[model samples]
Target: MSFSTQVKNELCRAAMHRPCCIRAEAYGALLHATIFSHREIRLNTENAEIARRLQLLLRRAFSVDCAPRQAGSKIQLVLEHAEQLGHIFDALGYDLKNHVTYHINRNVLEEDCCIAAFLRGVFLMAGTVAGPDKKSHLELKTARHSLAGEETSLLLDLHLSPKMTRRGSTYVLYFKDGASIEDFLTSIGAPRAAMELMEAKVEKTLRNTINRQVNCETANMVKAADASARQVAAIQRVLRTHGEAFFPERLRETVRLRLAYPTDSLAELAARFDPPISKPGLSHRLKKITELSAAEEE
Candidate 1:
């Protein structure tokens, strides 16, 4: 299943114990419903859990019944009669005389529990979170700009912030950073989803770090190989241009060891001595030989 679907299914497992929270959650679902107004309430979804949750919420929150009709994978609930719509509109503090404005009523979400529950309901209907294998993204989509802005304010009250943007006719509120997405998922009772997001981030970071280290080591090996090749060429030139007797007596042994192990690094060459010489000593001898080769050319 998709990450968003997994999260919603997990959230559906939350117990409906608190009456205020239940009503507030149902209230959030209504505001984001396909159509919720003075005349009718229409909810459409392919998720059987969501359809079932809304049915339960409508019944428990307002003592209203909304029958679900199934066609293929989609289930739709439509309530149009005045008697059924009146209970919902009145309980949510909406007047039957006015059309729905789609703005959140802050008074209904006064408690912290209710606020979390309400946001959870909102996500069940309109929210989506990308899988950890891809990118970190979470967004809530709504048709009303005012509702989006008002929801931002509500989130701010809980110390959570989201950016608002217009996508065609839809207004979207989203979180791009992982931390914010984690906070959002946890608040909506999906801690497992948040932990999965964190794990994905950690894995990506570790993989990148290992790649950089391997590249650094490979580059160092190439650099060392190039330097060794130049040293061997210089030593060969010095020997070809001048006889072994031309060397200083103290340096002849160093030259012999170097010629014997052309591929050895300075440390390995130094260690080959009967009484090991220092790496700097070996490097100095090699440098003198290269200088002498250049002098012979001049």
Candidate 2:
């Protein structure tokens, strides 16, 4: 399957059992989280599109009115019914455990790259200004901005760690800014999303690995078949060119029948020839043809 299809399939499985779930919203959050968690650099156009899509999803899924605030850099969702929205998402399987996982193993580094972009967008859109902290990594600055108009600053630090694999690469994300990761997760209802998303990622990776193995096997079979066809053709060409004029009428017929069905064993070929040629005799004919072909090539 294509990479997009694979990601969709993983999403489908993760979204299973929560038909009433806010699929688009949750997926948007995941996508946003993914982009925001990793990359340090991105184009403005790309960031805008992600923000637009995410805003649409959140609005559609949660019925929560949200607009791009902070000079079109952050999204401001006025959640007077925060508890109600939380309950709905919780019912729909939104949790921190669901979001933290390596969803697809194929092109892992690339996948992480996408996730980082997503997280960056999410943070910016969620009214959190992201910039380099003292350490020069991404840090979420949620202070009462002139645009936010007296909202308290909420500080959170998100970080991604590169992991080496036997054949490729992978990544993991953490909220380095939180005193307790669990507390932060519980507050945001991320565990359910985290757990489901992580499971989907693992399952998707396994499927990809299996597909690669299957493709390799099929390619090997095709190669073997082609080689066998060439070998049989070579034998026939040698026999026709070098030995046809010397063979007796009956011997010629017997040899032709054997070569016509090259896969037949010597015993099967002998049965078709009058007086029943022995296995050794059949072997001699084939060996002689091979020798002729080799000598001609040399």
Local distance difference test values of all predictions, in order: 0.87, 0.40
Candidate 1 lDDT tens digits, 174-286: 99999999988898789998999999999999999999999998898788778777766776777886778767888888878877887787889899998999999888887
For model 1, give the 10-residue run with minimal summed lDDT. Answer: 289-298
Q: TM per model?
A: 0.83, 0.31
Best by TM-score: 1
Worst 10 residues of 2 by lDDT: 147-156
Candidate 2 stretches with Cα past 4 Å from truth are: 1-187, 242-292, 296-298
Q: Go through the candidates in order and give the C-alpha RMSD of each one to the true structure.
A: 3.4, 15.7
Give the alpha carbon lDDT tens digit for every residue of 1-298 in model 2. 4222222222333222221233423432443242322211111222433345445545555554545444355433323344534543443444433442323212211233333332323333331211211111122222113212111112122232311112122212223332233233222333443343345556767999999999998897677456445557765775667766544464566557756766555577777776777888866765565555666668
Q: Quote the positional error of residue 33 for candidate 1 in Å.
A: 1.1
Q: What residue pairs are clashing in model 1?
A: none
